[model samples]
Target: MQTHARRALATFAVAATTGVLAFAVPGAAQADAGPSTVRITEWMYKNEATAGEFVELTNVGAAPVDLTGWSYAASGGGPGQVPLSAFGEVGAGESVVITEAPAATFRSQWGLDADVKIVGGVTHNIGRADDVEVYDAAGTLVDQLAYNDQGTGTVKGPRTDGVSGEPKTAAALGANDASQWRLSVAGDDDHAWAATVGGASDVGSPGTSRFGDGRDPRASDGGDGGDPGSGAGIDPHWADVRINEVSSDNGDTPVGDAIELVNTGASDVSITGWLQIDSGAAASATPFAAKLPDGTATTTIPAHGYVYFSSTKGLGSGGDGVKLYLPDGPGGTAGTLVDQVSYTAGQAGTDEGTDFGAGAFARCPDGTGDFTSVAFKSFGASNATACESPVTDPGAGGGSTLNCQPEAPRAPAPCPPPRSLPRPGPAART
Candidate 1:
């Protein structure tokens, strides 16, 4: 449950303008985290015949990255701190694996594909409550991941072998949050699932990377962040962005259950790789955050611009909430939160016309005000002025705003209980 920044290259500093945490390095520049630029996406704890002790690296970034100058190291286990140099330039969305066991031995254990990249000479033994790291050419920390069997490490994982640590890789920063990982689902989270591939009985998909299609939420490119701008550090422009409005149930509505984002700043902000999470009883079962598609042309919101994300079933008529985050999730860590608003079932419904029968939750004065129930749906245009009745206490109606609150500190999502899965047999690589 704890992650240590092994190096002191950077320190935390709040952006005076936004009051958001920024890595205050002497010369921190624009750090762009793609998916998880060369991340230690998955690893297996050693158990005799159950699983192989190995570390998997993935280039979740937007572009290919060289691992030639990169290195892998393990701690809290057999190898003290022997940094092993890696080779190959991983293409975007590609995966390359390293292990101490024979490539064939590791493959047979996991039923991995022949084409899957594998390496031997992993002298380290993956263990319970162990730390594993991947560093860039400059030795900048790409990711230093730690996992424990009892859901006690930075990520809840493989208490037993064959069940590799399958952290969700969509959010970039979410990669590290225990809740965003698999294998710890049983008893840890409310749901459970498991898969056996390549004749391997492992409980996780070690080499597969799930993205946009609606799995995995962790993301990041490298040292700074992939929080779009927020993913790496605090964006001066983040303060001006707001969760303007939300519509629930009314899937029949043109926009279905939708969310609106507004930028109050003068200059446009790029939100590529940004993420949206719908947290509610219904959503909690399969909590998947939506990442903005890459490309400035489609991902940018002009100054004072308004953008709406529409869907069939994100909100629950009973009660649900929405949040916006920067894509800065580093391994075993969460992304920077931008805005969040939770609402009750009554406030989550279409207009019933009564005091509590309002149709949607909208900012009374538009983008910069508190959320009020309204009987209208403003897709991309301005909200209806007649819509009034701001919840005197946003929390009174089962609604709370993280970024909208006055002086509230920005929050990183706490690890959620993992979905359930029959743990893989305990045993690491040869």
Candidate 2:
């Protein structure tokens, strides 16, 4: 489905990994809170708009939750903290959004309902690999959402459905692990990227879903009115696309991470309006990484063909991952997960291009096989399989960049190296 409306909200982007948002000194973990049964459900850390970023909470429990004296702060220390005194109370099964944007502006941007309980005053900017904490009047921590690096150049955490999904719009229902977290699309699911509005790459729906896509989950004023069963707003490409190869720790080619995708189906695929999200790269900035600039060499993947994506943003050398979302035209919903691939330091050859995965992870046999470490990254071409001979370039220091530190050291060859990547084995039927 194409975007049904226009989204003007924008998220702020981190220009560089300058260690801006720091971790707060650890304190005793707090869990008990009052009557309200709430959990931190969704949040986007890449608040390129500063005001556009937000955190969503849902009352899954039976009782209404009052949050008069509650405070919102980052476990990962960032901007000033905000007290929830202004938010009044949140009814059962309802959702409320807390953001740095002025309440009116936030409401207008996401097209939220007046009764949805949108509030400003959040000085805490969500950061990569950080925690969102909510404390009660008595200073007792009620909820702490520890989100691993899902996305920033786009953000999603593990959905109850599959892979570590981005938390940008992760939907979690009462005690359930796997929930139908809606795909981030622009048509109707999420706000479409725009230079003046969301700064491109921005995808999320704060105060949108109350934990589920069922019509019943939308906020009090009446939900976004999407028909859940029909799958109205998803992009068709989501069904045929696949993330074939990703070069995150690109010390070998240091030209930046190169994402190679393939048309798994027999038809061609155009990725003009698609979104690319990065799992947090503490040392780099992925601001424009989500979308490609004008005149990119290739945006269409021919029948069973490959399109190499040269990213404007680089992946973390130590460890980082990449996510691919289906395209959404202007005002179109675009966050249907097309494919995603991630890597660790050792498995990724670490940032310096020296580790087991050799800083590159690929789908052996190109588009059909499960992803595994390859001899080296082969963008816009067939995947360099582990079964192939080892070939580290002499120009970049003879020996393979092998420093499996924090783990065991690795062999100098990508030829049949240990398969230590997380998403190993057969790829999930994404």
Candidate 3:
């Protein structure tokens, strides 16, 4: 009875449609055609990867071209793609892995560089140590991966390293020869650290690996513009919020409600302008821009990983009240602050309320205890009826504890552990 007693809040809906536009591959390109070069001949078990685990891809030129949807990025994050029917064709020279969880658990060891044999449901899981990057449809990033771990000073894989001279053979997994490597904070020749080769890393036989060079040698034009400059921008301390206590179904109404952004840090932040919901209302407000009314704008937030937003795209379905804009500053306002919530109607149960409910949306931004500070419930309720944040009221938990609940319906949580890049000692002559 008061979700909007004040009135006057309309201008913030610019997303008629903008989702299919990812393809940026460029740290080094030389060959061309349709599927004529392909690379990456080995990789079977990355020592047994288990901190967050991993698996990668790339190389569809020298005659392959069937890596399927082919997508991965995380040095700065964005474009996970890889659902090319799951995996089948991959001919020519060959090379396309992608694994960390699904692939039939390891179906006899992940298989397929040419050995063939991977036919179950075909959309497994894919996640172990994310923060990947490998666009190329037209978005253009070409290559990038680096969670942490260079060991021998610079080796995301076995691209050859007689001693950091870099160039042992296999072209170092760059230019598309997949080998599932991942390492770079600005080390090795810097192609962002290209190596990639997934499908259950047991990679032939090795002693140490993890490289994915290629951070931007000026290949330029990653397309898909919302503009964070494309360097993978980020700074609010890495942001990483969660807040979800409920309350805000009718009065003061801004529109449904929900939050969650987590990147923690490893590079790639660009929620575009940050602030999923700052209610201070206007110290400099505009913040929330991971955008997804269908316009889908999330560029990258890997590191610790997390990217949800809600207010009833499901559950009891009852939106209106999330305006955190900033896309990247230029004029739309700069967008600041960083915390807000109050969506009850149907209170996040499904329709994809960004996976709300089930409790989660509080990582602590200011809104205190129990987290997600708002209150008011009753939409189809049942996680105890949801709503928490508000105890003694230390500012009311402006935001932070990582809360997220909409009314149950959960089953999509498998990516979080990547953070280990630091071993490259020398290499900068090209």
Which structure among the candidates has the greatest TM-score?
2
Local distance difference test values of all predictions, in order: 0.48, 0.46, 0.30
- lDDT for model 1, on a 0 to 1 scale? 0.48
Q: Give the per-residue lDDT of model 2 (tens digit) for 13-109.
A: 1311221222343463444444437776666544224236677777766667788877777643322267776767776667677876787776665
Instruction: Tell me the spans in candidate 1 whose CA falls farther than 4 Å from its real position.
Output: 1-36, 76-86, 151-160, 172-175, 184-200, 212-430
TM per candidate comes to 0.37, 0.47, 0.24
Order the candidate numbers by TM-score, best to worst: 2, 1, 3
Error of model 3, residue 122, in angstroms: 23
Which runs in model 3 stand beyond 4 Å of their true positions? 1-57, 60-329, 333-430
Per-residue accuracy of model 1 over 85-182 as CA lDDT, tens digit each: 44476677776678767766656544455556677756655554455665555555556555543333244443434445555445533244443544
Model 2 weakest 10-residue run by lDDT = 1-10
Q: How many clashes (backbone atoms < 3 Å, residues ≥3 apart in a chain or on different chains) does model 1 have? A: 48
